[model samples]
Target: MGNVKKKKIALGLQLLIALFLGGAAGFFLPQFASFYQFLGQAFIRLISMLIIPLVLPLVVVAVAEVLGKNHFQKLLGKTFLYFFAVTTGITALFVFASYYLGFGQGVNIGQEGASLEGIATGVKIDEFFLNFIPSNLFKALTDGALLPILIFAIFLGYGVGQLEQEKKEAFLSGTKIWIAAIYKILDAVILLSPVGVFGFIAKDVATTGVDKLLGLGQFVLGMYLGYGVLALVIFPVIAILYKVNYVKLFKSIGDLVTLAFVSGGSSVVLPPLLKRLKKEGYDEAVTDFVVPLGYSFNLEGAAVYFALATVFLANAYGITFTPQALLFTVLLLSLIGKTAATIPSGAIVVLLAAAPQLGLPVEGVALILSVDFFANAGRTALNVVGQALAVAVLDSKKEKTEKVEKPAKAENVTGKELIANAG
Candidate 1:
């Protein structure tokens, strides 16, 4: 345990250094941009390589664990509601703030590096929803489409839940072992993250240069300001209502937040997050259920960025969103924006995907792509925080329900009140 804690601290320091070193290399060493870019892509690919083996079985096991318990449907409903409500509310705030601030009004990105075909826009809403059905399960798994994989895992886990008790235990036991092996592999991959962070930032800096950053300053500031409102203002209100110790909660998960910011992907942070949830006294079952799905679904931070990007992009092109278009964008983001995690530069892909529907220029993607590493740091931190918040809130709800039930269970067992009533 002591060694593990020491390693975490060491890793955190390494990641911080990588962030600074990558930025310096990018800013001062533009000639070697390709080299840094290679390192960054290599790191992303290494982690991506682990996704199929790690994510698939982990989702199956988590869903199976949830299904085998009582009130499975109830738990799912409540948690999903909490995720949607918080995400929707915060997204509205982002849109309102960006619109009022007029972030992208005068900014214009050069077309030198902008390639509309290279962007992943023009995906229709019908097609987006249809793909969720997954015509080929193997293809979906190989392609690393998380929503389809999740769908497959849910069905398989439900099947496992219906098995005979002995067989169910055996299956679950085997699944746990499988997941542990994958985690061991991920442990090896995690050590390379600092190198990855350095490369990613350096490459972007070398290629994008200072001009893009200066031009997009307001959008970037507005993006961070939105996150600030969500983190400082909104999260605390929810925490207070849920009776959570907000300061303690943030401190406990600070390392995970740093990991997400540096890695720029929340999927990689799940193992440590689960460990923290357990250490912090949340139920193991709830931890298993909430954290995995929440990683894929509860991306409130990314949603905020996407919302701000939409308004920012519209303003950049001197376009305006009709009231109907604006409402549609918010609703779409609240529902499908989180699906961006299924692809590379997920937050950006989400923006591109919604570009057609929202009437924003597809080329605006290039503008955001240049600064994605910095933007992703903030968004990814929020993703980690959002998941942790879900666990805290839901776990608190569970405790309250249990507390309310304990007296009834005692009353039934003791029967002294029944005897007194009879007399």
Candidate 2:
């Protein structure tokens, strides 16, 4: 019997078809778009089912590992501070690029149907402060409130950090098992994303017409520009500083990122991604820690999108801010951007959060609301690739430096010397 080679179908291809169908349905039909909505909603909900559990245990493990009251603490503190600093810088760059590129001047002038009159665009500073603490855990979960969850996570992780060695090791072992189980569940669900993608695309096509899409093109262009600046300029330069080859890193993870672009949700393709990085000479500790941290804190794509979209909406409403308002907007964007998920609804959350603060008509967000789902597929993929590379460079440097002292002894002694001495 002749042997036939079986071909493995890549998830990226399926996600591409989903994107095409969903976009076409929303832009072409612009009438019966509920079908796409249902599909996209299904895909997002499937992911939501995975993130809470997947993230919590992983966070627990990462915190326990990083806060060992030794070198681990310094390593983590440095990595997080670097990521935070760069993210803030990237935020500034995006705001600057948006202004310099004149994205504000391109807003829709006569398209005034979705009114957000009397809507609260500005948030009180004190209430925003109070929202940081979780008054009740159950209430937070029911509301999908991220800040409270984050506070709880930080506290629990700190508690884990305080455990005795034997107990901590026991917890770490059990936590790993739980994390593995969650990942398996995540993988199974992600395999079903194509159906969700197709439905989302087709339904969006059925509702929003092509002409309306054209009006939003400028803002889209600006967003793409801002994202490129960070990925290409900011992140690569950081890699160079750390002596990591940026080109090699990109080439290594290109396929996984393409899947992210096609799938529109990086979270769906994360299992394969972590595995791929492990194959490419990176540590599992780094991948597990950095990937989740990036998801929670490092939102480069949404950082760009939030600024660009907010400006677009602001322009549409004829609202121009002074330098103070602009600075405040950037600060708020830092928080919203960090919370931005690798999901469709994330953009809406950011848009609504910023609208009231900037006096950008909240309803104007509806303009980009439909396609924002697909817009961020590329964004999420890019972000995952960028953050993964960042982690690789940081961890490689860390691992290399830790090994510096061991290598000198290798040069001075050999197995022959050891055997002679033993005899």
Index of the highest-lDDT prediction: 1
| TM-score, one value per model | 0.84, 0.79
Report, for every candidate in turn, its global Cα lDDT versus the true structure: 0.76, 0.69
lDDT at residue 4 of model 1 (Cα atoms): 64
Off by over 4 Å in 2: 1-5, 17-39, 111-132, 142-147, 251-256, 259-281, 313-325, 339-342, 359-363, 400-423
Q: How would you encode candidate 2's per-residue C-alpha lDDT over 1-423 as one tens digit per residue?
A: 369877867776767776676666666676666766776678677777766666566666766776774555665676688778777777776676566556768565346535445433444556666776789988887776655665576577779889998999999899889878877777787687777777756765575566666766766666677677767887788888888878888877776676566556767655566657766656666666677667667767767777777776676576777777778888888866665656545656667767766777666776676456556865787777767776776675656454543544676777775454333
Show model 1 residue runs off by greater than 4 Å.
1-9, 106-113, 321-325, 342-344, 396-423
Global lDDT of model 2: 0.69
